[model samples]
Target chain A: MNPIANRYTELVGIDHPIVQEGLGPFRTPKLAAAVSNAGGLGTVSMPGMPTDLDAGARTFREHIEECAALTDRPFAVNIPVGVDNNGVVLPFTDIYIRTVLDARRVDQSLAAQLTVLTTSAGFPGDYIGMIKDAGLIHQHKVGSTRHAVKAAEAGVDVIIAAGFEMGGHAPSKAVHSYVLLPNVTEAVDVPVLLTGGVRDARGLASALAMGADGVAMGTRFIASSANSDWHPTYIQAILDAKEGDDVAFDGVYGPCRGLKNAASLKLLNHQEDGTGEVIDAVELTRWKIESMQRAQTTGDVTDGLVLTGQVAAAIDDIIDIAHFVPNMAAGAAEILRGLASALPDTEHAFS
Target chain B: MNPIANRYTELVGIDHPIVQEGLGPFRTPKLAAAVSNAGGLGTVSMPGMPTDLDAGARTFREHIEECAALTDRPFAVNIPVGVDNNGVVLPFTDIYIRTVLDARRVDQSLAAQLTVLTTSAGFPGDYIGMIKDAGLIHQHKVGSTRHAVKAAEAGVDVIIAAGFEMGGHAPSKAVHSYVLLPNVTEAVDVPVLLTGGVRDARGLASALAMGADGVAMGTRFIASSANSDWHPTYIQAILDAKEGDDVAFDGVYGPCRGLKNAASLKLLNHQEDGTGEVIDAVELTRWKIESMQRAQTTGDVTDGLVLTGQVAAAIDDIIDIAHFVPNMAAGAAEILRGLASALPDTEHAFS
Candidate 1:
């Protein structure tokens, strides 16, 4: 028996409700397969926005195929919907969503393996219908209760409540998890996953207590042993981060959380809400993506932006995913049962 | 036996581990007594510092006596430790601590009723010795794991982990509850109570799951029906708040969370980390405190600063403390038990 399985696990066909959420602008094929092998839902991330849309789509397909080869368990792909200020969907978002749908059409085994499509950053507008028609569980991440309600009303299967403390590309509303999670859960009937400030079993149990069906973590998964695909220095930076060492900077999307290094300070110091300078907007976007990739590809902790969650301070060790995932769920189950049994029967005093 | 009794409730001699934490710079004697009478630890707030230190002390003593008279159950007094830039204890902090100690020394009944002392803002430093010597349970509020460890090492009986989302004067570190609470619980042996972003039974259960002994709330208590001492408009403003309405500005202490009104904008637009202009430091400090008091006394929520936590968005109705406190604890225990029992048995699947 999976000690913490619920509707979320049953819907996703995973043994545990835990998920290694998308850590985009970086690669996570190996990390995704490792978590899936451990009986938790894993996710393949969207690579950085390269100049060629077709090349970006090819890279995404390779990552999915690589993950399917490693584990037979079902997994997911995260595509952050990029919308322009004029509300028009960006070219990359259009290309990536279609890439996944077309790839699944060509191969039946790949279609079965990649059963979930997760969207973040912006509202997936009409893409929700396409994903649902493609026989994929649609999970849309939101930072506000209003958005959660709107998404649920629009037939989204799941909602991932993204808090301000979440890693790369946080909610523009800046709502913390403790205050936002319950509001999202209450607003939507579909399963809700809390995405921010979660590190271990205690966090998973706390998420359940706050009315979330499960937890979707990014930083914790980034610091695990299965993330050997990432540079050692990137993982070390996360382990070495202390409280207040992280800051939110203007990312390609909205505000992004990362270590307080030289590269992030450069972004925070300039840019006066798009009023300071009339430089190349496209160039600036590419630079941000390149800096993030540089950190992961080459171990440059100082100049490269190390996107991480606030929970990075609490994480010191690199965990082995296979053992850590199941142990975490089991531990959370034990804690909940233990606390219930330990309640002192002072009912008469309360009356 | 209480449904949620633990080291914290046992230490404070309260039926439940819930605490209506300090909402200082405002009178809360009636509100404090109502919570204490309802079986949770209630806290009498420190009155604003008038020009006369002696007068302020007299007012604070009266508030404590009023709370003691209203409730035979044990209660607490919240006195913020104010220290100057040079690290000298401010006159107001010194006077208020002495007033609580003197009141307890003279009247044995008052001493028995006011058993707990909570100190926030600055570190208690040498005053820890005085509080312990006076036979009061010393619970210091901290915003980081390092400070929690320091307070626990200095003989504090309990630690209230104040998150960045807390109302009034928040921690300088700005750590959120989910990220900081577990870190504090792991760093120290002292029973930790999570402060900030907590409202109902779900928050209480989440706190336990995160390893905290209990939860302390300021914004949740401020919106209660017992807080009639506050202007009805102030409570209504909190009720009307939606997400992203609250902002952290330059407060008397490091930072403060409150509604985004005209009063808070005045502070945020000016003052460049004490380097922009020659701000009459004392005058600015007095004006800030006066504005906070003005909102509480008068129903000027728009013009006067309305201090509140981000959790205000989640709270819509005023609750009766007599029914809310103990029932919240019971509800949390039920939720914990329900979640544990709902876990599906799939251990063989993981193996």
Candidate 2:
């Protein structure tokens, strides 16, 4: 078998460069353990989020400890840097970041195992040195090449070039993965993990061929059995989708790609009337919490949004994580081998 | 506001539905006149065909005297159907289709108001019935929905359901058009003109939303000054397509979707295992002559098998046809106006 030869596999020490994103509330200990056990990086979102910095840190410790008990493989935590809409600085944001870092520092077992820390949303450039100094590899997610260059220049260990096609909160720049991946790969010296619209082995092989060292999947993993804690309808909504099914909506700081449904439709109509921007955090938070609870508790797909990538086109069937991840790696390896075998023989090595 | 109430529309008194297939050599003046001026229906392929179908039909005193002196509107004749297959069949299929149809047809005049015939491969479907049936219409082309079913559904006046995502000889069975145009518009009432990957306003408004009264096009038409042909490179390779950019060698009976390069790759590696049924005369002729010539004449797009449906994704800029066709019917009468607005409402009606 042709092995996956990439800087990501070497640096992350995973068999394949598939990294699971930390989807908050949905990123349970079970899902994280399954991803890590499956030979890809599994990440846990900070537990009991929006709590005070100390409470959030304590929850993070308990969760990391739970994951450590389940799988010995490396896992990461995603810390979204809180945005300051007004000029007034929020001390809570700094406390949260510092508290998460301190929590990781104090736990010897967690520190030894948490090989990567991915900071997304707001700028992570200021904290990259501190993250690296904490003895964890620093990874930053950027939506554009400008941001990618900024992250790389800041000495981030890896840059996640999240394309417009990806799920969760995508940047508003709107460059497609086909254009973004190759451009960032050419521009950056560090290993690039291609995120967005990557769902299968063929996608993996295609990404590698396009020069990405690895891929990061959010929607695909969320639909897996390990993620069954959510409503089956939520999972089914994702499974039923094809490439163009999802459209992005403007979230708090940026655009988020999700299944377009009643709620989103309302949001769209509101935007059309210029009423969407006025929704404050309290209203947004209540809507999100209610939507998630209804979706999770009652299996109602229409109640909330399920984040997804354009790669939904390729995902017709959903399989378990145990079978899905390794099979993806193997299938990609096989295709690469076939590609190599098909290459034409050439002369002029001396030249 | 108008709405497209019906999926199919009838002209004159044709028994079958209305569809305008690409007619290459088979695009005859007799054919166009027989289908249209007779009232049943008709279309002439685009001009510049090698044969003198345009001139030949004009020569017939009765043919010229009767129809050429009457009618006004657009008709169609197909551009050459390019295939990336090396000249495996002798005598060039496209030339034969072009020559035969061109020799038989006449240039459209005001009175006759010629509608063009378009064939993706070889000659267009037979036009004897259309000629015999006065005022009857005949347009036949298909990319999906079982070519035979699409072609033979006796109720259809025109049957062209080319997937908006297809490029060239898009066989219908492989990938469904949104799972096969709502299952072939619920298995045909009449008038189904569809083509692979038609781009633009009327394309979306009419075909997908309205269920198509008639639809016919060649890729180059969009690139025309009358259209938006764009850069030759953009037109040729279709802007840096991915590996799955096209589907070829699908083991189906008709042409497949894809760019010339991917098609060429498949052709070079075609299996000689002989486990499958031998290709028939029509299939062989289409592959060897008709498709090959078009590819050669058209250049690398044909070479790369650059037939595309997904190219719809990249076609953001609007062309003139984008403005014209809509206005034509949009301003027509209450009946036409109703048809114009029907599409979006129908699409939204589902939700």
lDDT: which candidate is best?
Answer: 1
Task: Give lDDT tens digits, candidate 2, residues A215-271.
Answer: 889878877878766677877887787534676775545676677887666665565
| Clashes by residue pair, model 1 | A1-B345, A1-B346, A1-B347, A2-B346, A345-B1, A346-B1, A346-B2
Instruction: Give candidate 2 regions above 4 Å deviation.
Output: A48-53, A86-93, A275-278, A344-351, B1-351
Highest DockQ scorer: 1
- Tens digit of lDDT per residue, candidate 1, span A142-261? 999999999999999999998899888998887999999999998999999999999999999999999999999999989898998899999999999999999988898888889899
Q: For model 1 chain A, where is the 10-residue window of minimal lDDT?
A: A270-279
Q: Estimate the overall C-alpha local distance difference test score of candidate 2.
A: 0.54
Q: Poorest 10 consecutive residues of model 1 chain B by lDDT?
A: B342-351
- Report the lDDT of model 2 for residue B257: 47
Q: What does candidate 2's lDDT look like per residue over B1-351, in tens digits?
A: 222223333243332122233433222344443333322233444333223444533433333233344333333344433343562322333453434344435433332443333344322333324322423244455544455264555433555655524554555233333334433544565555555444333233323333345444444233323312123544445545532344444422354444546444455345323344566755654454344335434554544344444443344343344233343223222222233223233334446
Residue A161, candidate 1: alpha-carbon lDDT: 95
Residue A87, model 1, lDDT: 92
